[model samples]
Target: MQLLALQPQRLSAVVRAPASVRLVTPASGMSTYRFNKHVISHHFCANCGCAPFGFGVGPKGEETAAVNVRCLENVDLNAWPRIPYDGRSV
Candidate 1:
């Protein structure tokens, strides 16, 4: 399962995508967010419900960073594996 971002300049491209996909990003600020030591906060479009990018906390207090789309797949806990995306900023 891969949600590819088409534009290289968009937040979708900031994170590595396999191929062309829907693009969404914040006008400013970090595309990534920090959460915990091993986890972070990633975000996507609320309207379309797509993963624009993910933010994961780094080791110690280094800071959070974007996790791969594959990581998002792991975040899913349903038989269907479809996660809801929020897009207030995007």
Candidate 2:
């Protein structure tokens, strides 16, 4: 019947999360990301937690990029090439 109306739980939409949330807002921009959906944004260094990027919400929510540049510096971390990611739950 119209391919069951293209089931994906029949066009899901019930957004509202809070079962392990964390917020310490200060908002900025750029380096956005989105992937597979689940939300897990990143931007550490609250004294030395080092993490520059790492985000979520893709395939439908739009905005996933997956990041990390040694928590960033003034730029040019040796021409960028440090692939061994798994930043322990960025």
Candidate 3:
């Protein structure tokens, strides 16, 4: 999964959701898993076993979604600046 860090406000502005945003699950069904004392909820496609995104609480205790940018359409990934993160350390 390609991770692009986007602020919640920016994401909401881009998506234009005034209230809340909902993610559409795959037709076959979606399975969820949580690690590290259930801090983050990882969502996966049950049929293909591919992860689409994750739901977690932000640093400020706000709900956040970590979307896999690879799932986005009609976008040039190369154009975006890449910020490397050491997930293992976290």
Off by over 4 Å in 1: 1-24, 27-39, 67-90
Query: Lowest summed-lDDT stretch of 10 residues in model 3?
Result: 9-18
Inter-residue clash pairs, candidate 3: none
Position 43, candidate 3: lDDT: 76
Q: What's the lDDT for candidate 3?
A: 0.56
Q: Which number leads on lDDT?
A: 3
Per TM-score, what order, best first?
3, 1, 2
Question: Model 2: runs farther than 4 Å from truth?
Answer: 1-40, 48-51, 59-65, 70-90
**All models, RMSD in angstroms:** 12.0, 16.7, 7.0
**lDDT, candidate 3, 1-90, per-residue tens:** 243444321221122122354566552467898887686777777778766667777666777666665566775656665555545666
TM-score attained by model 3: 0.66
Cα-based lDDT at residue 49, candidate 1: 48
Candidates 1 and 3, the one with greater lDDT: 3
TM-score for each of the candidates: 0.30, 0.24, 0.66
- Higher-TM-score candidate of 2 and 3: 3
Candidate 2: TM-score? Answer: 0.24
